[model samples]
Target: MENAVLLNAIIENAIDGIITIDDRGLVESINPAACSLFGYTPGEVIGKNISFLMPPPDRTHHDEYIQRYQHTGVPHIIGIGREVKGLRKDGSVFPFMLGVSEVTLSGRKIYAGFIHDLSQQKRAEEQLKDYATHLEEIVDERTFSLQESVEALQNAKEEVSLSLEKEKELSQLKSRFVSMASHEFRTPLSAIQLSASLIDKYAQPFKSEHIAKHVGKIKNAVGNLTTILNDFLSLEKLEAGRVEPSFAPFDLVKLSEEITEEMQMVAKQNQHIIYQHTGKESVVTLDQNLLKNCIFNLIANAIKYSGENTFIEFNTEITGNAITIVVKDNGIGIPEKDQKHLFEPFFRAHNTGSIPGTGLGLNIVARYTHLMNGSVDFKSIVNQGTSFTILFKRHE
Candidate 1:
């Protein structure tokens, strides 16, 4: 009696739908879960054919299948489980898993069925598939955009290469033109300088200070033109990449002394250039011609910018692995605004009012220093003075 009561309680409270049918496929019992699944009451389903709860073709063949199983001892859904369709009282169709088992009670055969609803599980699976499809679409769009950006960058690189090539060709043409023009102008300039010197020599006999004065002006003008032409020629060679440094062992002290003597001859009245040397080891390996040109440019600038009777200091120092040369002058120094561009080609300081200059000197110096693996730097305060320093690694 206790076992019967427990079994009845489990079946009545079971979560899955449960049903019992006779051998003729007539419903004998139905649980509350089964009633809820089929939208029917126990009074409506009990004593009716179980086929009424199954949809369509299954409803028609259900009774025949049960008779075949009873006579032939063959089992279709009996003792087996499969997914099948069910019908509700409202004519709605749904899917479920059904398992059937056969039992004998009081000389009569009965079949029990268990139904588990599959609607919620099927819906969740479908939603996962849709989300996967959406992710694939987003990945494809981002890949296409990345490909387009790479192609655009490639196009920009090609354009820059073409522009650089054109710029190189233009620079070559300019260099050639300047070279030709400098050569052409020098001949006439030389003739004018010679004639002016002769006129001054001849007028000295007449003792006429007026003719001497005018001749001096002519000589100075011719000299300035010659200097400008030389600057242009030097710049042309440098831009054309023709100026190569030829390194050799040379005496730094001797070179500095010779340069000082040569430049001192051209200094303004009462202006002096003081030369000094540090460290007894004066020999260094460098391109002598290039070094001379760099030093010459700096001292010339000092002489030109400084007031008459001022002193220009030229110093050279030799230490372990380093060689330094400094040229400082008390001259009309560069302004703060113009100092940043001092080494750029054709850049003149704003403080240079009425002072004649081609503005290529410091630029040439900087390039020459770089060719020899050296560096050049300067400091200047307006109306006070300017100092330029060049340093190189001493090659032993």
Candidate 2:
């Protein structure tokens, strides 16, 4: 009996909670660890009914379950660790794991059980589940915002393309209007000039100052009309791609001198002109009329914008493999803000509002320069002067 008591003492002090019940469902023995697991002291739970540790429905049904199991000796979850719930002495419930084993002693049945508390583990798992839900929500919100930003960018690009198409249509419309205006105004002005000439001619030689005055007005109007018409025709041909390049050997020197001489008459009212050739007499391959037009137009523009008697310089030089001609003037220069638009069709300087112009001269000259495989560049200082440099390939 002493040996049996000592062995029972050894099993009761184990770290793992231990308990045994008879096949009749009565508490046979229990350990100190089992007592601590259920909030009880040793001997306080030893012979108590095992149903005392189960909750309401389970407590009432446990005896019937044991009776059924003893009759059949069939197995369910016994002899295996399984998660379950346990009721404490204070009526608080906690999660636990349970395992049971059955044995035969003296041809009678016995049972043993192990129990583990899981309150802390349950709390940790709940916290992890909450964090996962929050992370999923954050990812969903950012993905939605990114989709909105992409949609906005696509919309902006479409708007820009539509605006560009409208601008192209407006440019073509303006060109048509200018062409129509030139045709409409030129016919009436031509009739008036012929009438004035006939009156000056075969109608008796009147020393009448009034006749001379009237004829002068007719001539002035005709000249102004012609200038406008010429500008219109040139701009139209340039824009329509009618100007073709015909390269041949030509006298750049004589062409330069002739252009300057004609432009000198036009410049007489505003500026003085000087033309100089600074290199060996050289012949270059280029279209004579186109090159002449370029020089004449440059001189005409310089003489128009400068102050009275301002000196205009026309210079030509043969440098390396190119012929460089420069047209410079001491005039009211273009503003910095307007420089970027200088070569654009119909772009004029702000200060030249009172000056007579069609606003397409530089654009034409630039196109002709490019067609001849050359480059045109200019420098201007406001209220000071402007100079344009034309570089043409000077081939032998």
Candidate 3:
């Protein structure tokens, strides 16, 4: 009884299911572990067939298997370990690792079986796999979001860079204006002062040849300073949006003619002026000073670029409701590349070799023309000639 009690204790404490089937394939004994594993009691399963513990098609074929084992004595089914399914008392099926061994003792043939449940292990492995997949998804989403943020930052940086470039350009323009005004103004003012002093001292007779020469020098110096001052003041007014036009009836032909004469006198020895007025003598409402400055700059540029004997053609005409003035010079015309930057402040053409200029004349002309609600156009050839046209609204 002590030995039987010890066996019962071990059977009850065993963690693995143990069972035995007789040669007839009927369950002969089952341990408490088996009872717990398949939800069967010793009393209920002892007299029952072992096929009840097998699921599906295998359950129905168990008797044939046992009959074949008895006749042929095959060891394949009697003592083999494999993965198979089991049927519980509750009619549910689950996976298990089954081990079988044949035994013959006490003149009774039997099969001992061991079973290991696989459900819990399968579930744990699946849970870990799901966790890894979820982590990978989270990482991919974060990477995409980070990329979008970087692109946005790069675009913002590019926009900031472009705005900085524009600010730098405007600042450089201001610096150039200051430098040109100081140097260009002082030299002309000094010449005007020197000429006035010499005339004051040597004017014993009003008809002196030296008096004429000094007087001419003083006049030229004053003219240069006046032109420089006009450009600076006009540009300032334009930038401030305060260039209001003083409209009045004025002679446009006379302004053009006088500017042409002045330009011809300033040109080199070989350059001459040919100016004509084709429009009717009609009065126009405009700012006379602003219009005269524009015309003078245009004509002066024409003569400045031409050879000594080259003739500059100045033509004026009325077309529809607009007045057109064209100035053409047969001199060293501007290159195609330099024409694009013609109106930019302080930008001189690359081909302008040692020409004495502040490079602000065309810029001033463009600003004043825009203020007058007019437009200027030009065409140039390298060594042939250049032509400038201005179109203004006609009014009286």
Candidate 4:
């Protein structure tokens, strides 16, 4: 009597729902928890088929399953736990875990089942999935923002590097300009002063030839100053983006002759300029003023570098859309080492010892040729001679 009372107390207080069914699948008893779990009264479930608490197709197949298990003595869900849906008294359904076991009293067999609601567990799992998805989205957004920031920083670094390079180049140009000005200006200014004093001394005696000689020296000195100023001005215009080519049709032969004629006054003693033209066409379209400056620089350089009695050849050739100008001089040529820097501003050849020049002639010529869409090249042999060629496309 005491053992039976203890068993009844345990079944009544158990947290999980408890159910007992006969071998024929009839519900014989239900604990209070089982009644509340399925929204049923013990009187309503007792003596009813156990399939009443199960939702179909479990309800439809429950009786057949029990008959097969009883005949074969094989367990499908008898000793194992599984999840299944239960039908409530109000016809509502919910998930639950079930475990069944078989017991015998006398010749009668009974099945007991334990049940637990799984609603809370299912809700928690769904929340975990949502949280993971939101985290991944936040990480992707931050990674994209970081990539953009890196690219912007890279562009800023490149801009800073380019600015520094330009600053360095400007600094070097300024240093070269200052040195050239001091060296180039002092020589001509000193010559003009000396020549003026000598002219004053000869003025008291009034010798025509002597006074005329010093006056001629002053003129040449002034011309040298003009050339130097022009070079500086052209360089400034180029750097300031102010020089643009203005093309027009003109006679190549006439232009060459005119330039040669102007250079004769400054030529060395007994020196002569020989001009020649090849191809039928002597007329071409080009930036005349720029081309004239280029030719004048070449011819003047030839006269300045060569000795007395040397011949300077000026030749022009026109073929289809191309024009070529050659200036060949029989003079002390540039050394092999100095040829590479021939077009650099303020650069002078080592072989030009004591020569009176500002070292800007070739550099200015090169700039002028570029403005006119042309190229200048030269070949030189030490102590032998030098030749310069200018090639360009005809403007029209």
Candidate 5:
């Protein structure tokens, strides 16, 4: 008697609604929570058919389902919990999680349903989805703004100068183009990257692998576009005579090691950038920014052109009166015919295939080196390997 009273007390005090139905689908018992949930008292619901508490087709077919379960013994909702619609006495519908179990009591089979309300959770999820949509809208707006800016630049490029000298006009135009592109393109690209990261983070809990993959693709494409824009900006600055090498004294070993570590994160599977500095002297007096750009461009090219599991050899040797930086790769090297025009702006190698690049990387590197009193040289054999060396004469 104590155990029966205890079980009844526990069921009545449970937060989740509980209801029991006879095999014929009549409500045999309803706990206080269940009564409160459906806006019905136990006296009104206990002897009534449970279909009155279900919405639409469920209410119409509830008896059929009970009969089918009794005859066939094939369970659908019997042992499984799933989201379902519930109807209240006020003719309103709501969402809930219903877990139904079968119990045999005194040689009679009855079904017990455990219900947990899901209206609040559903509302929260909808709000989260709305926030994500808002983020996407912001990203789209920024992307459209960047497009308009690019169009404006193109229009400016087509206009003829009125009074200024041709060289000066062209220089000013290039400088404006570089400045506009840098600001316009970078802002949207950064938004895209950030939005993609947030979307990936939000989708993680749902185990949305495909969403994560597409987000990764968006980030990678944004990175590539940013890289191409940087190349164009660098080329424009060089053409407009805006870039000048600022020479400084820095540790070459530390710079090279940092670059190697940073670039390794983006390398292909098993691809390694092996960096080494030779000679006792690790200090060099040169344009640190330009030199770093030159090295980064070469290693990036090596990684792009090389296959997985390949090694990119990056070595810096400080010999007497001279410093040499070499990047060697055993990838698809440039064809002999295309070698001469490799450093030309927008000129991709004939053998480059579908690899994405602006073809301005080498040009920028060459110009940067020339500004710093350095020389760029490369030797390539198609399908075998390529090696690029940047030689700088140490200034006293």
Candidate 6:
């Protein structure tokens, strides 16, 4: 009685579905779990063929398989386990694992089969596959976004670097302007004051030569002031885009001669400007005023920077399509490091010590040359000399 009660309790509480079949493949008994698993009750399933719980093919061949097994005394599914489709009471099919074992009681053989549903495990596998695909897509999107952010940061960095360079240039220009005004203006102003005082002191005798000497000194001071003012005005006009070229045909040789003569008055003591003309053609069509300013600035620089008794060569050459102007001076040549920035506004060489200059001469010359559609190039050696060559295309 106790063994019977234990077996009934074990079958009733088992997690897997359980069923018992006779040798004829007929269902003899089923547990409550089996009834719920197949959507059936114990009374409805008892005395029915076990084939009724399997879908077609398996249901049709089940009886033939049992008969073959009994006649041949061979086991096919009687002691083996496999996965197969099961049909529910509602006629829906699902996957389940079936394990069958043979049992003998009172010289009659029966089979007990255990069934495990695979639906939840299959669903969990599908969910894991879907999550893996979703993760890959998210990673790809983030990688693309990160690349775009890096490119944007690089562009922003370049823009900031350009802005800093421009700010540094402007600050240096301001410093040059302040230094130029104080040093350049003081020299001429002091000379003019001293000359005027001397002229007044020697005025009583009315000595013409002494008075003339003082007058010459005053004139030179006035000329220096005028040159500084002109440099400032030209730079302002150039920066404001207000200086326009007026083109005309002019004799290059005559222009060079006139400028050289004018520059001689301001030349250092015992220094002279030698004018030379070469090539066949002398006339060219260009902006004469702008060209004049360019030539004068070069010659004036040559005169100012050279030592006393040095000769400045002002040479000009004209060809069929081009005109070249050369100004060579025996002066304190520009340092190699300062040559690169020589044409920049307000830039002065480190070697120009105690030289009264606004540092705008070469910058203005470059601007004027550019306006005339010309190019200027120079070669210099420290303590030896400096030579500048300007070339212009002859406009037909």
Provide the clashing-pair count of each candidate structure. Answer: 0, 0, 4, 0, 0, 0
Predicted candidate 1 versus true structure: per-residue lDDT over 52-119, tens digit per residue:
99899999898789788778877566655588999999999988898888888999778899999887
Off by over 4 Å in 5: 1-10, 22-26, 36-40, 48-95, 100-111, 122-169, 182-218, 239-244, 277-281, 307-310, 319-322, 351-354, 393-396
Score each candidate by Cα lDDT: 0.82, 0.74, 0.72, 0.78, 0.84, 0.78
Clashing pairs in 5: none
* Candidate achieving the largest lDDT: 5
Show where candidate 1 strays beyond 4 Å: 1-166, 169-173
Question: What is the lDDT, from 0 to 100, of the residue 201 in candidate 2?
Answer: 73
Off by over 4 Å in 4: 1-206
Best by TM-score: 5
List candidate 2 segments past 4 Å from native: 1-183, 195-217
Which candidate model has the greater TM-score, 1 or 5? 5
Worst 10 residues of 2 by lDDT: 149-158
lDDT of 5 by residue, 116-231 (tens): 98889999877766755665565465546545554454344335233346877767766776787778778877877887888788778866455555566677767777787788
When superposed on Cα atoms, how far off is each prediction in RMSD?
33.0, 33.5, 34.4, 34.2, 4.9, 34.0
- TM-score to true structure, per model: 0.56, 0.52, 0.49, 0.50, 0.73, 0.49
Greater lDDT among 5 and 6 belongs to: 5
Q: After superposition, how far is residue 362 of candidate 6 from its true place, in Å?
A: 0.5
Candidate 2 lands at a TM-score of: 0.52
lDDT of 3 by residue, 1-396 (tens): 999999878866778888888878888888887898789878989989989998989888888888887898774464446888889999988887888988888986778888878878777656655644553454345435434433443343344434545755654554465466557555755665675566546554434454455455455545555555555556556665677777687777877777877776688886778988786755666678877877788777776677786788999886558888788888788999999999886567887785535466788777777777889889999898888888888654
Which has the higher TM-score value, candidate number 5 or candidate number 6? 5
Model 5 Cα displacement at 155 (Å)?
Answer: 10
* Candidate 6 stretches greater than 4 Å from native: 1-205, 208-218
Please report the TM-score between candidate 4 and the true structure: 0.50
